[model samples]
Target: QKDGTKERYVYACTPDGTVGRCNKISIRCSEVDEEAWKYVKELMKDQNKVEERLAEIEKKLTSNPVDVTPIDNQIAEIERQQRNCAKAMVTAKDDEYMSQLFQQEAHELAKARREAEKLRADVLRGMDDFQLVRSKLDEFRKRWLDHKTKLEEEPTYTDKRLACSILGLKATLYSAGHLPRYKFTITPPEIEFLILLHRAERQPRPWCVSVPAG
Candidate 1:
């Protein structure tokens, strides 16, 4: 303890305990935790921000239209080649070399067909209909509302963490002009609508503060 004071600091360190890896960066635990919770509360309770996020999700879900016609054509071509190979194989049964060549070609074409079909399916799956998009967005909104209700109550540490997870929150520590600071990053949710996240950049020195939790 410094001067008989029970002081605590949040530290960034290397996994293998390498010297000088973390640049000897640290800050008061209370300071960092307080800053993090502030941002968390802001993000969780801001109804306008929530609506903006939902709008962004809806845009991402419906903005890009996927075309699988090329994939379909590729599959059709592969099938045609397979049919030709099969016919050739029947005629070349007496000739082992020709028969083997046709069989190998047929096998390769079949593999290509499978791959093309899978690509087609993936494209179709990603291209959710308008109704499905609405449903997913509605689900996300409901989840957010539920989380907000929990936040309004006295949320536990687990609840706090769940909020972070739902919002894809991340924390990073670094030095800002000899002062240790934290940066909170929020990535897009992994739920159906894949999109980018808006980050909160705060500092402790002159401009801003940081965010984090235990």
Candidate 2:
């Protein structure tokens, strides 16, 4: 909302006579990073015996051989620690321990996937919002086409199902090149939310169009 073409700016002018904006900040995930890295190192330690040896040998053949002093010390350290794992295996209740480990692993994987999914949804939502306010015509056109095609090819619906599902408003099923291309199913169990969105562009209320029954 600039007044009569008065200047508008995202960032304030800098001392060097240039507009400036800060780079996006990425929040620190130190704890998660450390935990993931530690797990990776532990897993690699178990599997790196032959792989590490081969890599070293290959590097030596192609470039230069690594100094043996440090390599020998690392090998000695690994050999010394190998018995710790062996001792754990020997003293463990294998079945119970493994079952608990498997459950924990699955729980962690699911938690990670959920967290990632939320992040993805957030980013997509943000993009949709930003686009709504400041999208190019080309971008909108492309998405409109995609949505229209999606509608033709797949209309997830039943009687009285509301129209207009929004995909970040990036795409709309009403646009060109996409209309009911094929049949798609709408299942009753798919109603995960009470409020439904659809692909039709009617007013934000239910329409009263007469259904012609055969």
Candidate 3:
């Protein structure tokens, strides 16, 4: 079958994506696969995406991009809502009504401030989680690539699954290998899990990797 003979092979691409290739051959020696060109082409398509990303990076380079504008927006909305409360106070013309109005407005402002602060904290936490996830995904990708490379050196091996797994792109791998069986493949519910996880109040002292023995 090596001498220009055709053979059938199934390729599981993305989740719910598939392709079949027969008698594929390469005439040139290459550093990366032909498919890698597609990735490069994808990156080349949009100048706007590049410029937008640059702007986002510049925003991050500034000191503390998070601003009080969200809080300001909430304050404005609350003030509008409390106008009726203010009018009520004016009509009553009693010290008790004035005190009540002040307390109500104070509570509304406090609630808005708290909500904005919580959202800001959540965004910060999400950025940290993204970094952690990228690191972990990189580790997985490296290991998957190494394993796939070893497999390639053998007499027979298909790189279909390996390429996808290398870059955190293996959802279809599970689907192909008897979908009903491995259907429950894991996905990162990072935000949901992080919400449940409470940070330890006390900082744990750093421990040396090895303990010196007497």
Candidate 4:
């Protein structure tokens, strides 16, 4: 307490060095931290769920491993045929109809080659996304499970901050009347998966104290 009034602690938006200042966007740290911990605790307790999610992600990745060998072979054969057609066209240059036939064959082969290349790219992209989600989930599991004991009992400020960082927690403060209102957002599982797939940057660790959560 400060002069009989309770001291206030908050998370405020950082301001730019010059004229760019935040419009006093801040949330009471305790409120946001408690809410964030509730969600983290729920997730931590559900080991079965976390394992299931990991299994699901692994199944997707393993069942559809990214192998572009077949596509590459297909493209190779198409290009070979295209080269043969070119040779045939040169030899049959006097025969306009035969040359046209070779030209048509070349066009078809080119189209098939393009399609094969596109399929390869698509396969690679899909597998990359799957791998990305799997990696993030693996990291989340490792980080949280490593601190299982501490989490089960009482998490320290550092533990809670770590959880909030991993979970992508966000708190926004606003004023409606004379009182301040705060909104909190926890990253949803599906959206988190998408975010990982899109290669979103990792969240920075929040400023925290070492004291246990009250």
Per-candidate TM-score against the hidden true structure:
0.55, 0.21, 0.33, 0.54
What would the per-residue lDDT of candidate 2 be over residues 59-134, giving only the tens digit for each residue? Answer: 4333522234543554455455544544554555467776566556556555654665566565465445333322
Choose the strongest candidate by lDDT: 4
Q: After superposition, how far is residue 169 of candidate 4 from its true place, in Å?
A: 12
Clashing pairs in 4: none
What's model 2's lDDT at 63?
51
What's the distance in Å from true for residue 189, model 1?
7.9
Between 3 and 4, whose lDDT is larger?
4
> Which residue pairs clash within candidate 1?
203-208, 203-209
lDDT of 4 by residue, 1-214 (tens): 3123223366554554222325455556676667667766777687786566556645655676577888888888888888888899899999999988988988888889888988999888777777676666666666676555656577445445445554555555554342435555654335334444235333322332221112
Candidate 1 stretches with Cα past 4 Å from truth are: 1-35, 66-70, 121-140, 143-150, 155-168, 175-178, 185-214
Better TM-score candidate (1, 3): 1
Model 3 agreement with the true structure over 82-176: per-residue lDDT tens digits: 67656766766668867787767767766875787787677677556545434433443354333433322322112222222222221211222
Q: Give each prediction's root-mean-square deviation over alpha carbons.
A: 9.9, 27.7, 18.7, 10.3
Candidate 4 is scored at a TM of: 0.54
Task: Please give the range of 10 consecutive residues that has the lowest summed lDDT in model 1.
Answer: 196-205
Best-matching candidate per TM-score: 1
Off by over 4 Å in 3: 1-94, 146-214
**For model 3, the run of ten residues with the poorest summed lDDT:** 203-212
How far residue 194's Cα lies from its native spot in candidate 2, in Å, is 28
